[model samples]
Target: MKSLLFHRLALSKDKKGVLELSEQGQEIQKADDILKDPYVLEFLNIPESYQFLESELEEKLISNLQHFLLELGKGFTFEKRQYRISISGKHFFVDLVFYHRILKCFVLIDLKGGEVTHQDVGQMNLYLNYFKKEVNTEGDNEPIGIVLGAAKDHVLVEYATESISNQLFISKYQLYLPDKKQLENELNKLLDDEHDNSASR
Candidate 1:
């Protein structure tokens, strides 16, 4: 699925002359770059523009896990929806849990209905710590945590993630699907901008 998207964009190399994708997978990108900023949730039956709660989005994604997985990127297998982990004397549930085959790591996702916060990042960080120490096996890789919010604040993300050891990320979610043709056009524009920058340098 990821290959299809890359091929359609006719991408070869970026301004840095590095392949966007290789046999291993998306190269050495930080968690933020590794994850999509505005994840499209077109699989849900909601209208193109509609108000919804975090639970609503989560339920819709769970109802259509197959489509959700596809949008989630490649090599992802659904492990558990609303996965639970016991901490201290209390039980906490992760909104979604997926395992990435190629990456060989557990992917934990937390959904936010509105703006993301430092608290959300801290919660996900705690989840990562627990998964790494308790849930993961000898061969398991360190877990990756993602906090998906309806709105994004770059400043908040930078401040919240600073000094955090976990590979945590925060990104926005879009309720509607993007037009493929429109996306292609945007890709071309990006390529053109890259070319222009390279020429200037």
Candidate 2:
């Protein structure tokens, strides 16, 4: 009886080890597949997608707000939309503004309906500058800016920041959520035969 119990214990250990190794193998395969994906590779270098502006974002604002946050990448929270800021006897409105707890800085966003221009970038920078000067607390970091538009010229964006010292970002906004076809394709690619077999059991 003692020998039988020891044998059973050894078998259980071996089974657990095999299960762990299998899980590790699956993870590695998934990582490799993600790396080979064209969209994933492109996003790894630049997480923001440029193809989003074709959708009617402003018209569907309330309906697509959650999807919009997901597409904005990580560490972004929706604070307020159409935020009001008053300065110099004029009222200025920022389209969207978020406070990043980790960065401890206010993120100012401006929504544009067409191709992003130098003027747009300059205006965003000005907003950041103003917030940093007026609203930033002693513990807060410098404010950041994101110019969300229909399209952005990378070179022009860089040129627009030639003199600005604040951390500025440019991203395109999409009105619609990812289509069913693309979502299905990604799901199919992510799910493998092994996953199906496991589910069958």
* lDDT tens readout by residue for model 1, 1-201: 533444323332342322444444555333443566567775687885677877888888889988888777766788987788897889989999998776778999999988999999999999999999988987778889999998879898999999998889888876754568966777788778879989999
Candidate 1 off by > 4 Å: 1-34, 177-201
Among the numbered candidates, top lDDT falls to: 1
> Model 2 compared with the native: what TM-score?
0.57
Give the TM-score (vs. native) of candidate 1: 0.76
Name the best candidate (by TM-score): 1
Worst ten in a row by lDDT for model 1: 9-18
RMSD of each predicted structure: 4.3, 15.5
- Candidate 1: residue 27 lDDT (0-100): 53
